[model samples]
Target: MKKKRSNAWLYFFGALGGVLYGYDTGVISGAILYMKEELGLNAFTEGLVVSSILIGAIFGSGLSGRLTDRFGRRKAIMSAAVLFCIGGLGTALAPSTEYMVAFRIVLGLAVGCSTTIVPLYLSELAPKESRGALSSLNQLMITIGILLSYLINYAFSDAGAWRWMLGLALVPSIGLLIGIFFMPESPRWLLSKGKEEQARAVLSRMRGEKRVEEEAEEIKEAERQEQGGLKELLEPWVRPALIAGLGLAFLQQFIGTNTIIYYAPKTFTNVGFENSAAILGTVGIGTINVLMTLVAIRFIDRIGRKPLLLFGNAGMVISLIVLSLTNIFFGDTIEAAWTTVICLGVFIVVFAVSWGPIVWVMLPELFPLRVRGIGTGVSTLMLHTGNLIVTLSFPILLEKIGISSLFLCYAAIGIAAFLFVFFKVTETKGKSLEEIEQDLKDKHRGSLKTETRTAEQ
Candidate 1:
């Protein structure tokens, strides 16, 4: 018999997919500053270049669902790995603005698919009891990627070595490709394809054979009811699921956290810090992000999702308020600079442990088995759309309205996100996908009755 595989080995490498996605996204954060100088880009042009990847991401996310369904999840990830490799090489070699934009789009496509699929893939592989924490490994890897990129930026920032920053993403991309080779295909996906024995075989590697059999049976029953198409997603019950998933997706982007991730170095320079200080400051924020995400991974299955959302979003509102005040009242003083950093640091930690990781965990669980992939893809499409708008508009907004006003807008959006979570987002911790779906169906039934009564009145 083949040696029983431990999930530890699988998770380490499978999570590398997230690492590549994170590195690609994070590399541009600091590299964009240098790219602007080398390319002679204005604020508008810079926004255009940065936003271009998001456009690809929107489409990539939309397409990844079908790709995974038709080709299998493992193959889909392999395809993304190819894109990451090519995108990294092309981006590093680009000689002009148009080439860079196009290359970044390539990376965006890869990043989009990784972001959408890794958590889903991981969740599908993990047992229900440990699903929350295992899925969070994707987010943890993302923070790691971000921190790695910040370190790379700082290392190269002195010589304006933007190419190296972008090129280095190639390392993880190649590593991810090699690592996926050792992975077993997701048992859930295998079962869906009618390869029951193959699915069982895969599951056996992850757990005891009897447990694998029971779980396979459970997944089969859940999937039996999931025969759905696009229109199925619009059914009264299904619509609520879509709203909950997509709302968080859009709100995650609109909260403007990416503004810090993408433009922190430049933003700090504009505010008051020297180039070295700004880079160091950005790295500092990245450090907080990784550490807090680690803390989150420890407690996610233990603490529950709603509490994290409530706690984090509430703190975000406060942090953004403080950040805005510091910028407006204190201007460019060293004290204000430190204050800005502290507030952002808090926001980073809060979000790292909450919305950042939790949203990815929630997306896959929000839909029924039949439409889960498409539903997730559609939600991710909206997310990238929001990201596009925010990324594209940040520079223009900062120039036209200033940073204080931009952050104020984010603070207001935070209030709306917090309320949405309190009312709409249900806790899914420690629940299997089947259990979550049944609960959704029950809520849908009650909601339908209430609507019928209100309509009669």
Candidate 2:
């Protein structure tokens, strides 16, 4: 009973990084609207400002695996919290575009590292039976962050307070820094680092004394096998998990999720809604995003990963197609405006329930204990890379191709995402992390033998 109460607090603080990730990313959607006037922005500079953090994130996530592996997850997350503080305060106070870009990159580093560490930390700490629901807390907080940003965007829309929107990230970041101090480091990480006594203590605190021994022994055995590095990531046995993690990461962003996240206000304005109306529309979409993510957190364990993903991909594809038709045929009418909002709502709804949570949840589950940190980091790198590409190009693409055509392209990508999930992704709904890793090893061995037999024949 005591452990249960403590864990709820632990998950809340540990996943607070997602709120910062969501807010920093989502605030830009509204902030950029007001920013264009004061900054003397063009498309190129706009993309640069929006994507600089992504650039920083690329490096942050690339290095975080080693950082978390070497220094420990709790410390890595604490460092991210500090970086978030610096970035938030700096970006809000910047006098010019160059300074703002530099600060945003700093924030991006925090975002990158947190995204990798938070889910990894949560998954390791959670029991297998509730891992999906517990891990989904990260996504749930992210949607809440995005929703909060949208509300703030609306509140300050008339005043044009973009700086405040960008700066408010400091509040939760500070909260995370304080809250994390009271939380335990991941037991698996402790065990892997040869801190078995500490690991057992953490597990005892988290899982109760009776369950700690079995779980500790399991982690110890897995840790004894190999220490994962870049080379291990490329080895045959780890490749499938690697592919699945990377694929989901790529498709999650490439399907145009972050474009809406980072540019919904701009997109709505382009569709002929007034500026206030545009930001308000995004608030509605943000609301749906939060609500549906709750639905996902409710059923991710029961419904399984692949089904939710396939359903979401199909829904997103249809929503984008409908959105495209509305933009092309209606062309800025009142009818077109409402239709666009509804389509986006549907898109957000399905996305929050499926791709949004599942990608983060699955990345940690896909790899073995040895490679989990690096695997998650590499996958997050791909996620941010896709995000950077889409976000940096969105305004330019919107200008050249227009919203109707852009959404159609997204719809096409959604199709590819659906097919990829159907073909390449596996179900990890109820299996223990060790069980899944063992399954991968078994499949690899079976494939090697089949190849040998075929070659001899």
Candidate 3:
């Protein structure tokens, strides 16, 4: 009972980080209209402004692993909170577009770190029995953040109050910082740093005195087996796991989820809605995303990861195809606008319930302890790289190929993603980290022998 209480607090703090992430991402969509007018941003510059954070995210995600390893997840998250404050205030008060872009990159650093470290921290701290549900709190908090942002933005949308929209993130940043101050550090991280006594103390506080010693021993053994660097991740047997980690990461972004998310308002306008309705419609999309994420949190463990992935991908393909056909057939009529909105809402629902949470859950779980940090870093890098590609191209693609073609392209990628998940990915629901690692290694070795036998034949 005491352990459960302690874990509840840990998850509460971890979810705080997710709220900040959601706030940051969600704020921009609403703020962009006002920011563009105030900053006199042209279409090209608007795209740049919107995507600058993603560029910053690439570096942030790549570096966060090393920072977390050196500083510990607790401190790293605290540092990100500080960055969020700076970024949020800076962006809100920017004197010019250049300053806004620079501040956004700063915000991106925090966003990137939170995105990678929060889930990892939760996973490490959570008891194995509750890890899936607790780790998923990150997504739930994220959706809540989005929903909160949408509501905040809606309330403030009347007077072009984008500054407040951007600045509102400061509330959660402050909240997260304060909340984290009272939270315990991950025992796994403490053990990794040879702070075995400290690890036990934390575990005892969270898991009771009876279980602390055993749990500490398991964590210490796991840490002892870990290599903890980039070169260690390059071993031959690690390759398959790496590919799975990075491939899933890449697929999560490459399926064009962000095109809908970051550009929902503009995409809606392109279909035929007026600006007012488009902005209002985005709130609906945000709501669906939040609700479906709730569904995912509820069912991820119950139904398992693969079913959700397959279902989401299949659903997205159909939705995207319909979205494209709607655009092609109706050509910016109100009918097309409503169809696009409905289909896009479905797309958001499908994605939020599957890839949004599962990718984060699986990435850290799939790799063995030895190279988990490096493997996660590499995979996160791929995730951001894919994010950057879509972020940079989506606007340009919208201009060049038109909306129908863009959706068609995304639908095609969704099909590819479904195929990959079906054949390549393993079912990992309900497995412990060590067990999953062994399963991966066994499969890796078996595949290699088959390859050699075929070559010899």
Candidate 4:
């Protein structure tokens, strides 16, 4: 019980990174309107403004794992907090859209690093009994950040105060910096670095008197068998796991969650809400997201990852179809208004509960220890690359194809995602890192052995 209580504080600090990520991403949905008006951006330029961060994120996510592996997760996350402060302040004070885009890219880099590093750090630190709940806190904090941004945006909407919305990220970034200062480094990371004594000291505090040596030994064995490098991830034995990680990363974005998230206010405006109402409604969306994410955190372990993913994907598909049909039936004006609002609320709920948390949980665990860092980096790069494509193209797609068609496309992608999860993905609910690694190795050997026997015959 004491150990659980002590670990709770560690998880809390880890979650601060999630808050910055959520705030930075969510703030833009509301800020874009004021930015467009103030900076006089058209659809093309507006897309660039919104997507610049995603572009930067590709680099941040792709590189963060390597940096974390080398410098330790604590230092990587601290670096990310510093980036968030710089990016938030720069974006808030930008004199033009061009400068704003530049600042946003900086913020995006921070978001990318936080998104990758925080989950990895949390998963390593958490006890198996509480890992899901604790790890899910990352997503929970993200929702809180989202909700907070919406509330802030709504409060300042009348004043056209997008600068304040963008600037508010600094508060949490500072909190993250301070909170992480008091937190210990990941024990697993310490063990990887050959500092077994230091690792044991940290784990002892979190694991109590009974299990520290056992846990340390387990960490050491996992590290011993790990083949850490980018090239190793492509070896035949590791290929399947890499593919699974990459597939989840790709499908998470291909399903188009961000299309609605980053552009919710704009979509709401299309449906007929004025700027203030749209911003307020965006807050409502964020609130629902927070509430449902709490629901997910409570049940993710009990209900299991695969079931939640299946349900969420099915829900998203239906919601997107309904959303598209509503736009079709109501025409561009009335239907677009209500349809977007209702559909987005449903979609956010679905995403928050499932893919949002599960993808992060699954990616790091799927790869072997040797290549975990590089594999995660590659997978995260795929995620952000997909993000960049979706974000950069959504506005153009909406304009060219219309909202209904755009939604229809997303619905199709969601269906594909549902099928992929139902068939291809395995459940990793209760397995330890070493157990998961052995399971993969056994499966790999079994496949190879069968192939050899068949060839001999």
Candidate 5:
């Protein structure tokens, strides 16, 4: 008899961790520039400081699967919220280079957990018909967080207030912690724990009383499968999804999106812009990032995942090629500066609409309920690995090869990513998670029978 609650609160607070993820990652792009002088950091240490989070993320994601599975999704998120506060405050107050990198690694742990869990959490809560759009809220929040960080960076750049830029992340961390307590636990998690009555209550509150029985039954049926763990991930039926999820995760980073998110200011300065002008240019890119993600959120459910991936990949390859040409031909001229900004803008627009949102949406959908947490963890682990490699190598590569060669290399990677999506990725629109899992099993079974017939002949 409790009044039905709106799912908006569920989506917002549930995905709020993404804001912290975006802010922490995006703030570093600007903060590192100022802090480099104050902390006496060179390129080697600078890459270490920026990429240290990825190392922590690697471990955090690996651990989060078991943590969320054992403790439940809400508590896992709550734990990450706590880490965000500790890491943000510690990083801001650090005095030495060692202290800063250590604290950033701590922040990375929280980022890793949030990135892996938020999309999974949202996808499990959303109905299959609207799951793509609903889960994309996590990506949308991430873009907002990035834009917020850029704004903070521009505000603080003149004064070189890097500490303030890093510290402001604490504001949203606290908000997420407070809001999570009021939010319902993912009903699927409850069902897995054998609390069917409690699960139904949560479903009723979120989906109204009528839809609870059928959806709860479906989840229950899915759970009846052998409980999944890391071992089950390698089983023939699950391997395809694992390969696709990990592949997308890898390509998503290596295609060079985070280079823009993490090093746009540095990139702009390399072309010709001044410190403040470079930071301002990143703000423009961040704005385009947020706006275009809104476009993805609108069309993702309608257009399906593969098409977005295909279109976005092609656009990225073209933009990066153009960006490389402009930097090579124009060097430090005014024309190069404008062209650099324009190319990056177009790249962000395309990436925001495709890989940016779609990767997160598809990762959770790719796994079955039994292994969803761990599978997503493994996928995100790959994601953070790619991010670490690219983030760490970019500054070094830029110095050694110049921006033109580095970007051109990324464009070639983009072409490879486009081919991977065309050949390997599958459309997941308008399908339930259970349905997707069944389809995987069906295909695996079909392939095995074909091999049997060939052997008999």
Candidate 6:
């Protein structure tokens, strides 16, 4: 019950899911350099290979809620780990571009599953007192995983060992598979399934003896007050939450964040950095990303969500504007290269502290117990679908519209996202799930009143 075994270690293992996603993202940025030559890929084919994982992720997220609800979080995660191992190995050994694309899809499925499951799993398992910080381990490790991938990219650049770049993901995937074997199923999940005694035992260790029964009772009461499924999501009282959730998940991908994480190497090359310098620069960027995410995790509970989202978007808008101007004025000159790097660093720092972790934390928290699974799946599907669109389109955009034009577009999206948060999003800081739902209901009633007045007039 005391959990002398250390929940931190368990969380670390659980977050290996994030590590694989990061690794998959980072490896491709640099590997594409060699893969272009080996696979005879033009821009379109290369984009397909890189975006294949995102395509796979769409499927994974779409199905995650059903899988996790029916089979349990532990099993869903274990299934993902298996996919990671197979995908990592298959990708590294693929003899042709077509085979490589297939393998990346496999890896994408693993990433999608993790994105849907890991944060929710950690949130359900952690004590309320430390929920934000602990649940943030998913984002934290993802930054670490990206950093490791960049390091690998740099280390292998001279040797041209792109195969090793991808194959190494297998090591951690296997570790995740074994580590999951030890974790008890989520206590909240057990309670949802009516396995109260098993749920209490998990809670005794996750929280403590004094809190287990109380927390269990709270979950049961909340469940009693709610009705669930796809239909429930369309209710007037619930529509705002769904809109807010989907917006956060979707924009979080397109606010120009993944461009840096997924295409930093390519962007640098376009700006005149050599292959090795570009890869190393990516490592520096990845390091900044991880550090900022850590700082955000430390202060998120104290600072709350809405303020951070607003503040971070302000920084992103400014950075994207400066980068767009630089690219327009200097083109591929040396100064433009340096300016792009600095602006990207600023963008990643702000984004790391806010949207990256906050969105993931808010997703599971925003929904009621009855509809959490369906709601989570729907939003996650949108999140990855947005990711796929951005990833698939970036190369084509860069080629057709030019990088300056692309930066301007992202900057515009950033402004729109800021306005949405200001006008529409509610702050859920320090509120339990039930409390958040009540707040949303109050707003929903106001919305109905406004609609009624309009109709009567």
lDDT comparison, 2 vs 4, better candidate? 2
**Residues 1-457 of candidate 6: C-alpha lDDT, one tens digit per residue:** 3355677788888788999889998789999988888999998998898889999998998888788878889999999999999999999999999999999999988988999899888877776656777788899989999999999999999988899998998888998999999988987778888899999888887777998778888888877777777788888788888999899999998887887888999999998989999999999999998999999999988888899999999999999999999989888788999999999999999999999888888888787776776678778889988888888889999999999999899999999999998987888777766677778778878888999999999
* Candidate 4 C-alpha lDDT tens digits along 295-325: 8888887888889999999999999999888
List candidate 1 stretches off by more than 4 Å.
1-5, 447-457
Residue runs of model 2 more than 4 Å from their true location after superposition: none
Sort every candidate by TM-score, greatest first: 2, 5, 4, 1, 6, 3
| TM-score list, all predictions | 0.96, 0.98, 0.95, 0.97, 0.98, 0.96
lDDT of 1 at 86: 96
Between prediction 1 and prediction 5, the one with superior TM-score is 5
TM-score of 5: 0.98
lDDT, candidates in the order shown: 0.87, 0.92, 0.83, 0.86, 0.92, 0.88
Q: Residue 115 deviation, candidate 4, in Å?
A: 1.3
TM-score, cand. 3: 0.95
Per-residue lDDT over 1-457 for candidate 3, one digit per residue giving the tens place of the 0 to 100 score: 7657767877888878889888887777777867787899877788888888877777888888888877888998999899999999999899999998999899889878888788888888777666777788898888888878877777787788988989989999999988888877778778888788888888877777998877777766666765667776777667767878888999998998877767887887777666667778889988898888888888888888889999999999999999898888878577887888889998998999999888888887877775665567678878888887887788788999999998899899999999999987888888877677767667768998999999999
For model 4, the run of ten residues with the poorest summed lDDT: 331-340
Residue 216, model 4, lDDT: 86
- Model 6 gets an lDDT of 0.88
Q: Give a tens-digit lDDT track for model 2, residues 298-353.
A: 99999999999999999999999999998898787989888888888899989999
Cα deviation in Å at residue 342, candidate 5? 0.5
